[model samples]
Target chain A: MIEHIFPVHPAAIFILGALVIPLLKGRLKQIYLVTLPVVAFVNLLYLPHSVFWVHHIGGFELIFGRVDSMSLPFGYIFIIMAFLGALYAIHLKGSGEHVAAFILVGASLGAVFAGDYISLYLFLAMMTFSSAPLIFYRRRKSATGAGFRYIMFHLFGGSLLLAGIVLHYTFTGHTHFGPLESGGLYFYLVMIGFLVKAAVPPFHAWLSDAYPEGTATGSVFLSAFTTKVGVYVLIRAFAGADILIWLGAIMAVYGVVYAVIENDGRRLLAYHIISQVGYMVAGVGMGTQMAINGAIAHAFCHILYKALLFMGPGAVLYVTGKEKLTELGGLYKTMPITLILFMVGGLSISAVPLFNGFVSKSMIVAAAGLQGEAAVYILLVLASVGTFLHTCLKLPYYTFFARDAGIEAQEPPRNMLMSMGITAFLCLFIGIYPAILYNILPYPVDFVPYTIEKVVEKIALLSFTFLGFWLLKDKIAGQPTISLDTDWFYRKAGTAFMWFCRNPALAFAGWVDMTFARLAGGFLWFCRNPASALATGVDSMFAFVVRIFVGRQRHSPLRALKSVVGWMDRLSLAAEEAAKRRAQREKMAALAQGEVDVRGIDSALFLVALMLALFLLYLAVKYLW
Target chain B: MRYLNNSEKKRIVRYRKHLFYLGLLLLALLEIFIPRDPYFWFDGLPVFYSVFGLLGCILTIIICKTLGRYWLMKSEDYYEE
Candidate 1:
């Protein structure tokens, strides 16, 4: 192991840096924000290639830093992305978003380097909570709702992870964060937790649901971290599970199919995140050294190009306040730089020759071929074709090159363009020199990517896809519509749940309230003049009995009984009237003394008696048992 | 400032379709000369990638559009109402 030259956890730099952001302003804040990532990256370079920062508490170890081949690449790219994201958001005046974003970056790094389950769970939870404000930063109604859903989904996933951790610890008595034994409840629970955050379908709706609702600058950061972190943890823990292979393949094509019909520009890109991460997931499932490297490298290249892709639409949204492709057109005339940079990202993601995606994504596809998984190879290739069709062809055609929509727009801010430019440069650089990326992989790299056969195959595939697009260009244009996905179930279910609460649950509560009120009213009336009421009731009973005995005799012996009953009833009536007058006088006196209603005292006393009875029953049961 | 001037833009617009077709032809020609080591059984066929690309693209479009029209696509406020 390399000796420790830098022992400070990189997450510390970011988390502590976040505290200082609210105190700075103007260019100083920008400089400070940009410097924090740079400092963390430099520190990462010197971090010892071993587990450090281990602490034990309550018979459990919590490791804050675990730097090695497996995690180094992720650590490097995260810091780099933090820099790009910070630069992209440099012009914003608010400090809350900046702070939240910083904390999110720190939490992601914390997760990447965590060597124990406790720290990992903590960082993951922090990442979820911190990243949510970026969605909420949009401050729109849709964004607020989406943010709530986003947190709910992540918290659920986090709970599963926590439960799995607890169970694993109970089973094995260790909290070491490493590969898990398969075919157990904990294994599936942990895998599902990662899958949910990874945006694998059925668990994927939160991404496309919430991402498009983020602020323009915020979405750029949103694109980089959450799912990629999910991918990272999956890589670290569950590399060779067979189920992930088919799930990844399905997820790859799944995103493409949905993206084909999507109309929102950012939402469409969000779907592609699912698609791109699918490639990494499939690679991890392959369990070959080449496949794992490909997964890592693809993740690295994807973060750059994907962020650039988001930056393109984000820039457009920044300038024009529109995110729907149906609402944008002919922007190339005014935003040529944005268009060109966007296409670079577009081409890279499509895996055109000599772009970052070409260099990395091919590794996974080739790994599948080497493993003789013909079906998976074909599925991945087909998904690539779909990727090119929508991201490269459909999106740009509708947003930039189609008939003019007569919307006024111009280039975005300088910092935004600069960030996009730097990201585009990196994508190209990695595409040209795969060695830099290869050298950082967790394992030795020997595969070549620029072989002539591969080049020809990709070129021909993309070229003819263009032909297909030319043929059906009009049919695939963005519509003023939304395509349903798995979120449809939850969104509709949420609505149904609210309806149940509003109608049935609320009606039951109202009925209970009314019954209690009626009971109390009857009891209060009885309490008001109990003596008079009892006397009057007895008099009526006596009169009825006498009448039943001597029915049709006007002046029979029943007349005396009837007179006695009548006199009692009159006496009781007079007594009731006097009691009412006395109560009225007492109420007036109480009012003069600034007191409230005394009638409520009766109900309070009845409630106390009910509680006493319940307590007595509880004591009887406890003692008898 | 625009990346393409008016004349350049008009010129590209006029010849863009021709250029695309030319690109397709050139790619097909390159496939003939490039020595092939097929990874899959079907990849051994002549111009297999071109056919796959074309057919795959068309099929994906047809399948996704059909799904969208019949089931997936809904009104903008499908959730709200």
Candidate 2:
């Protein structure tokens, strides 16, 4: 009887519930949407720490829910964010957005709990397919273009990941999720795949390009899942790989450098997500228990705070339809709650004391210091300062407190404010009481974040950073401009490739085909005119015979034979030409008869009769054979 | 302009000055009292974080601005052309 209660996977709630979402109407739809994540959140708590819902196909075991310390924190934050994301998007009028967000959240949860590479790859692809619609659903030209690019990038990354899994399975003769041994193409392929999603430098431009193009609430949903899942997989597979430490350090600073020049409010925040994920990637690279814990903790905190940050500007965009930082200003006067909430998010991301980022980000920075990597430590610190400069100071200053653009707009809907409030409260709660989050970490909580020296040091760093911003505010004011990133290659190259295919490439292909066709046509003409060649050969042979027999007689019989052969050849050639012309005329007549206009049950009946006759013929052939 | 009174507008105008003085005072207090446990010798210096934060932001802004101006920044429809 106890076993009759099937194990409830958290992902099942969202994955299955998404289908029913379209059936719901109006307020019921909203209620159902909010409840799905709540159910998933509740289910995640009771999920056993061992793999459950195991099914075997052939010799392979498919483990759907692998709940342990490592996955739980990611899963916990994912479902929480899903609930908050749903609430934020509750005012959206369309069901398509809600459906995509559900599938995205569900697929991400499935990925984290996926105990095998097959399940992981499945969920990863699902995540990609579902998330693209969130971007494309906006239906704007830029959004649609960005959505295609986003999916294409992920498809490339997914192919690499799938290739890696196949190689790993072939080499190891099993498909299980665990720490991978270093040595082969599979390892590097898988690592690069994760890095693409993790938004490591050079491959990092997709997040900034696509995230801002999503619908305001859609970006909130998007910010939580895709990159963090990449980080989660990194922790699971490539911990202590050594290369991530450098790649992550580069990603940390690279994202901030881009964010500094960005004029789009959400795009700047998107870049900061790259910067923040870099901390997680670096922590995973450290491969120590404390560092891994730090990565996980930071992933959790970054999701909530990042979503809150997106929500702030999302609310603004929802009301005023402005996304460029240069176009928005003095919104704080009307939207004070959004200002305070956004500040909370900004502070959290900047790692201020009494915010979540401090509690988590400190662990990675401290781990670097303890690991004695001075260069990485310094770079991470610099990135922190940059984070404060752009996200905490520049973005809010320009969008909320800069000289008024004189466009007055009200605060966003209540659900958005409520979601922000919940996220803000969580950020504070985690910062003030780090133990709540620390206790749930994969490693034991041994680090303290609130030492007087640490607090004072953070204060000094942030305070001075604020001073720098204050001094440089005028000089650093946003312009109506877009900053180029690595996506420039694909965006330009993709366009160039399309042009090549349309014009030059097509023309070249046509020329090659025409040349080949001409060469083939010469051979075909010789083959078709065989009667002339035969007649010439026969006439020459007859003349030779007559010369041998008649010995130079004036009227040899060979001449008459040659004339007869020539006449027969001409007749055959004329007949053949006439047949060819007739065939061409027949073809034209058939074409002039136009398409067969079959409609209604007659076509269906004909198809059915053809299938029946073919089946009968197949039976006879099979029996006779 | 829509929501702020005259005093509120004046206070908002003075935000930069207040942030400057407050930031300077905090740095001074940290330099005087904070313990030194540097990961490296440079970090051991008093008010290392302040200098790091200030210098890092400036260098990042300058370098990013330069890069953005010469290479990264483009007209909004750059990709379209």
The whole-model lDDT of each prediction reads 0.90, 0.88
Among residues 3 or more apart in sequence or in different chains, the pairs in candidate 2 whose N, CA or C atoms overlap within 3 Å are none
For candidate 1, what is the recovered fraction of reference interface contacts?
0.88
The digit string of per-residue lDDT tens for model 2 on A1-625 reads 5545555778888888898888889899888888888877767766778878776654567788888999999989999999999999998777899989999988998999999988899899899989999998878989988998998999999999999999999999988988999989999889888888888887888899999999988999999999999999999999998989998888899889889888999999999999999999999999999899999999999998999999999999999999898899998889899999999999999999999999999999999999998999999999999999998899899888888999879988898998999999999999999999998998797899998888888888888887777777887888788988889899889988877765666556555755686699877876788788678768999999988987764478998788789999999999997686556555644553465464654689688889978986886676546
User: What is the CAPRI rating of model 2's predicted complex?
Assistant: medium
**Strongest candidate by lDDT:** 1
Candidate 1 lDDT, tens digit per residue, A433-521? 98999999999988989998899999999999989999999999888899888888889999998788666675566557556866998
Tell me the lDDT of candidate 1.
0.90
Task: Give DockQ: model 1.
Answer: 0.79
